[model samples]
Target: MSGVRLVMARHGETAANVQHMLDTRPPGLPLNERGHTQAAALGARLAADPVSAVHASVAVRAQQTAAPVAAAHGLDVRVVDGVHEVFCGELEGRSGRAALERFMAVYEAWWAGDLDARLPGGESARDVRDRFLPALDGILDGASGDIVLVSHGAAIRLAAAALLGDTAETRFLPNTGLVVLRPDGDGWALEHWDGAMPVAGDVTAGGTPA
Candidate 1:
């Protein structure tokens, strides 16, 4: 097996993020000004790595976030399928506290190993994993060296936890925050998560948001 490291990043900020909306849809909002700066910083942060490929989901924000990093490596940001955010379904565009709580409640359920839990009119944890794992495999198909993928928060958290058989290293995935993984036997080993090694029993938050 190759020593290829997978770096999964959450997309930069968007208006919806600031508003606390469940903004999960294809071709969703673009990154705001601050998001642009974060994108550049993320690019610079990873430029020195031997990044062989850069990828993004279908969301506009995700693509925008991957642009700088791909440019840094002289690589095109491959717009991939099935690696987007967790679909919010009926909660899409809803920013109310009740809806947000409901969504998080179900998301929390997935974190508790209840993969069948689904948001009303949305995907289940099992649904996310089925589509995501395949998309991730396809992204890795015939690929090598370091790779970067700009995606979403909950999606990244769910997938990474499932892949590593560990609880999410952090609860949030702030804009451009990274979750690094390396090949280990038939699975993967969690490397630096959200830019640092998490301490056991630590209840970290913002440090993980993206």
Candidate 2:
């Protein structure tokens, strides 16, 4: 407990999540009723965990998800633009199996070390890393204790994998799931992930969007 710990949480469920739509970008869909419940549960789960501050992406879902957690600690949800979801571009708003398949294909390529692979009219893995990692650095800069960040599924998976030097299979981070990291030298050391340390195995689910 010498240095600070960083918690990257995937936002709660949304209508876009239930319908499997590509809802990246700001002002995206808010959390559904179930999502609000999940957010509150997330807050209760972390209420006793000392949190120095709460940060979220510009997307409404991310901000909304961070609210209860922030309120629990008497803090406000600080929105950071660079942590937004990886834009789906031409794939925006589509929810068919084919759309998700194509999106997963590119994302898996990134986990397989193809950071240059770009989504169809969307962002490259490298593009996500560039913005996401720096934003995390700024959050952790001169901080202590724990910091909570609520973000999207794919973006969290992509950025977390890079930060932990992991190439694990590209599975979506379930709603409110946390990826914990601690400052290790100039980089990071994976402390906890999905309730365990980082693993190399693949975890499959419905091909979900970021």
Candidate 3:
């Protein structure tokens, strides 16, 4: 049976991302200059495909990132709260270096397959996976043609891990990177990861944007 194609891309860089800050709060800052360029590039790349839908996290950066692509495809950008970045809680608005240090500590535990280890007042990796996968499953079940999901790094990583049936370490997707998955039976199959940007005019077997 033919299955749905899910094209997931990380949001463009934000001012916080460029300055190495932790932006976990609502209405966080918008994208920086380079971030706008990146989003434009991503939109140009995605224009080659027939994107039936564009979904984004509700964060300012993510919404800004999805705007260009949605406009290019003539699709309304739907904000899905479920795909928001993991809540950093106390770490919100902290410097990126501090967040990195803390993230590394959490990552170490994640590498050891400990899903419960979490930053203070934040969701665990397992928590992210649990929330995101079901949302993704619903998207897949109802979607046809090509669907573009613009989301944060951590949430996208957890969802990719769930789809690929791998640990967190196996799911390192770069900012603005693209991961394409196709529904397979009751699960999903990873068709490509960090593949060429669609601007290069590369189309996958399932006609998804990469």
- Higher lDDT: candidate 1 or 3? 1
Ranking by TM-score: 1, 2, 3
Q: Which stretches of candidate 2 lie over 4 Å from their true place?
A: 167-171, 195-207
The residue pairs that clash in candidate 1, if any, are 172-208, 172-209, 173-208, 173-209, 173-210, 174-209, 174-210, 175-210
Native-to-model Cα distance after best TM-score fit, residue 8 in candidate 3, in Å: 1.1
Worst 10 residues of 2 by lDDT: 195-204
What is the clash count of model 1? Answer: 8
Per-residue accuracy of model 3 over 1-210 as CA lDDT, tens digit each? 164578888877776765566676666778788888988998999898878889887787888888999999888898876777777767777763455567656755755778788868887888888878777766656678788898876677667877777642344555677888877787778787883322321111111101
lDDT of 1 by residue, 1-210 (tens): 386999999988888878777788788899999999999999999999989999999989999999999999899999999988888788888875677667867866776778899888988978988888899998888888998889988788878988888554555667888999999999999887774433543332222122
* Residue 27 lDDT, candidate 3, scale 0-100: 65
The true-versus-predicted C-alpha distance at residue 105 of model 2, in Å, is: 1.4
Residue 185 displacement in candidate 1 (angstroms):
1.2
Residue 65 in candidate 3 has what lDDT? Answer: 84
TM-score of 1: 0.91
- For model 3, what is the error of residue 160's alpha carbon versus the real structure, in angstroms, after optimal superposition? 0.7
